[model samples]
Target: MIAQKAGGEATLLPTPAILERLETKRAIEGDRTVSGVVQRARGAAAYLYSAGVADTSSVHVDSGYLTPDDMRSLVEKGAVGDVIGRYITAEGTIADPELDARTLGLGLDELRDAAMSILVIGGEAKHPIAHAIVQHGLCSVLVTDEHTARSLLDAAPDSTTSGEDPS
Candidate 1:
């Protein structure tokens, strides 16, 4: 399932139409449950399942930036579930190679075989993260800006691999 953050304020983001489409397609093709990592999406899933709009499972993890107790509070308030805490080293930043990689890896490992694939989409902000996702073998697909796409293509060994910033 493709899980994307809704736009606007944290509380004002619109329901993701892509998710609805995927859910609908899966339902018409056969019984399938799409999984995602957002609280509102989870609530929507519950509603959709009840209304026969779609079938889905929602998994929520603690935000790595939040304190454990605070994150637990969110879970208690029904903002999230499956409170997996952050795994960090002494540096305070994410010790994992990349943010999305850590999230995807943890999701796949904790959820076991349920996680089939991961999709990362956005602009340049997601480029490095997408690279890490590919390196970690977490996501099979990546959606990015044209500039980032060209950069990736150029970075390939078969390409020229020249005229690029090494750092």
Candidate 2:
């Protein structure tokens, strides 16, 4: 909803987990027949996000589309979290594009320039992500449950030193 505050409408979508589940179910029921759905949705989203980034006219965060393999690769590469398709590193910088094809939406500049950035995701697993976002000043406001808040605070946070790993 931070986008609304910035005079833009928030376009909410299913989390990457949900999309992954759907894709898995479809795979179970059919196989590659349903995989095209992710591609179609991703292509359309990429187009829309390209415009958003160009115009500096919109903001969005989506997950649940990245497959387990995709997320695992990122995690292995020191990614703490992802938003709007872009990976956030431990130091709060977007992951380097060299790691993989960058996702659409909210480049670091776009995110920093926003009047306000809000993060509503949480979980023990999400602690590092929240920490990176907070330390990096990526989000001005955060909406999370008490348990998640506590966990995030309890988990020692790390400062992002650079956008990419030396490797």
Candidate 3:
């Protein structure tokens, strides 16, 4: 499970507090693994190490604010040897590892084909962004507050009862 921040002028980064809140919500909703990218590389490294999953590597994209030393500390802590430090142009797009891998010339589709789940936290303005992510097949599920969920559900196509077709 990898976490990537939502890109925009708002500077969205899933901090430890946000992750904790999301985890708690997931637990209540009967989910096990829930995580997201953090602003600090050290945080990302810590998260990956704590997860204890084999063959899994965590990435912390360069935010341009953190220094190479900071990134090195994160790497020393066990973040994946591969680190991404570049600007993504898409505003509402979720960071897909596959896309990241492609940009680095890795020539591997493991990250690209990997199934990713994103947790989006925001109000109405973020709805379209979330929708766009879903449309792009980047996120499998979206975890949001009740209000946002209601709004999305309301906007979604209505379904009829089984065996009853609405013509």
Candidate 4:
């Protein structure tokens, strides 16, 4: 909400928009200390916290100053994807119950409602995460390299994509 209000769209960046991928809690705080990006994100989180929408102590992110300790917590609960917001699984489940309760961002349902959601990601490590968001219908479109794209399709099971039965 704050990023969008401050001229940031919901489009995914090439890097991991999710915090854990950016930092390991001791890895120099990943992208938080970067020049211009942190300001907007921290500002956003601050506003949300002030508005009682988020808890700053939960703001353990180093990527955009708005991390709610997203990745590790969710990954432990079988989360495959960590989008810009919260943790979601390929089955469209919320991986981390604790983080989910305190986050001040859009829900998966809300993200799906955005006019357009383009996910930009790459790497073998990111395959599972990307798969969850795409499988869950959170992203309207994916913006990844051919290798990762093929990887996602190859990993797919014989099942419906949009809740429609193949039969």
Candidate 5:
């Protein structure tokens, strides 16, 4: 809806209802070979391929939260957040490792194939994860506010921070 308002067409994926059905099927059957699962996966992969994602130069990923605390919470107390069974953390780390395979969406390999991986996140709560993303080169480009950018620069390694040579 927002993108449409801005003149960029939005491509919506499967509805939650349809996704739930596929999830249920996956939980019961364990493989995509089962009747409907294969078709849907192929359809989605085909859609992505047709959408120019295969070119690696046009695919842009805009989701995933960067909060190490969220990962810690899920690990320490089984506490779930925005990443419970839905979102993938930076660099394809699953917030809920227990539900790793059950994640029904684009594979990390496909995402890594993209020429530009932009991570747009900010604020104190997310600083740690954002820094981690930069340190690990999880995102090719970052879009964030000034305060967070300074924080990241301060936390960055001498070689990575501005005004320092990589040698």
Candidate 6:
């Protein structure tokens, strides 16, 4: 694994195990059972993530690209953003946005909560999503091609220049 190559041990959280851990709660029957399952699974994932994040000194995330619309649809279930939805899980499976809430992946909040989120992404086609990620402060460190970096800076809102008066 990449962690081994980097001289670190990888902490693997298998999705099946995560779901299995919540299976008992999901055994309850009701009209809202499926929704409840989604909530429980999400909560379980969050708990595991919190434990991992809290114990770690740093985190390295290799995030994938989804158009802002796709990301919103996946995360918000079409309540906002584009109504049409497509999802790509962190494990790289393309799945129905509505049915794949249980897909194993890191949420935006989880990424931001990490002590360090080093985002690695680039490509002309990815510029928009990359820009959105940076604009939203999702990444504390970014590794990308020079062109993409320049584009990010160009699109950024103007701020006071270093060693200059704000007045």
Candidate 6: tens digits of C-alpha lDDT, residues 47-154: 211111101121211122233344444434312111011132322233343333333334555555656666666666556556655666556778889998999988
Residue pairs in collision within model 1: none
Error of 1 at 164 (Å): 23
List, residue by residue over 1-167, the lDDT tens digit for candidate 4.
75588665542222332333323322433444442343343333222111001233323344353445534555556766555456566577776755554444345665567666666777766777677777777777677889889998888785786787978
lDDT of 3 by residue, 8-106 (tens): 122233322212243443443332222232223223211111110101122332333334554455334433222122212123222333323223211
Per-model TM values vs. the true structure: 0.32, 0.51, 0.32, 0.52, 0.51, 0.47
Q: Give the Å shift of residue 69 in candidate 2.
A: 3.5
Ten residues in sequence with the least summed lDDT for candidate 2: 49-58
Candidate no. 4 TM-score: 0.52
Q: Which ten residues in a row have the lowest lDDT in candidate 5?
A: 47-56
Q: lDDT tens digits, residues 1-167, model 1?
A: 21234332322322221222344434433322223324333343111000000002222222123344533443343331221222222222233323223231133233222233434344554344434444444444455567867766665565335866666
Candidate 2 lDDT score at position 92: 65
**Which should have the higher lDDT, number 2 or number 5?**
2
Task: Show where candidate 6 strays beyond 4 Å.
Answer: 12-100, 160-167
Question: Model 5 TM-score?
Answer: 0.51
The deviation in Å at residue 65 for candidate 4 is 8.3
Model 2, which residues run further than 4 Å from truth?
1-67, 99-101, 155-167
At residue 136, candidate 4 shows an lDDT of 73
- Model 1 ranges with Cα > 4 A deviation: 1-64, 67-116, 159-167
Candidate 5 wrongly placed segments (more than 4 Å) = 5-7, 17-92, 160-167
List the RMSD of every prediction in angstroms.
14.8, 12.9, 16.5, 11.6, 10.2, 11.8
| Model number with the top TM-score | 4
Ranking by lDDT: 4, 2, 5, 6, 3, 1
lDDT of each: 0.33, 0.50, 0.34, 0.53, 0.44, 0.42
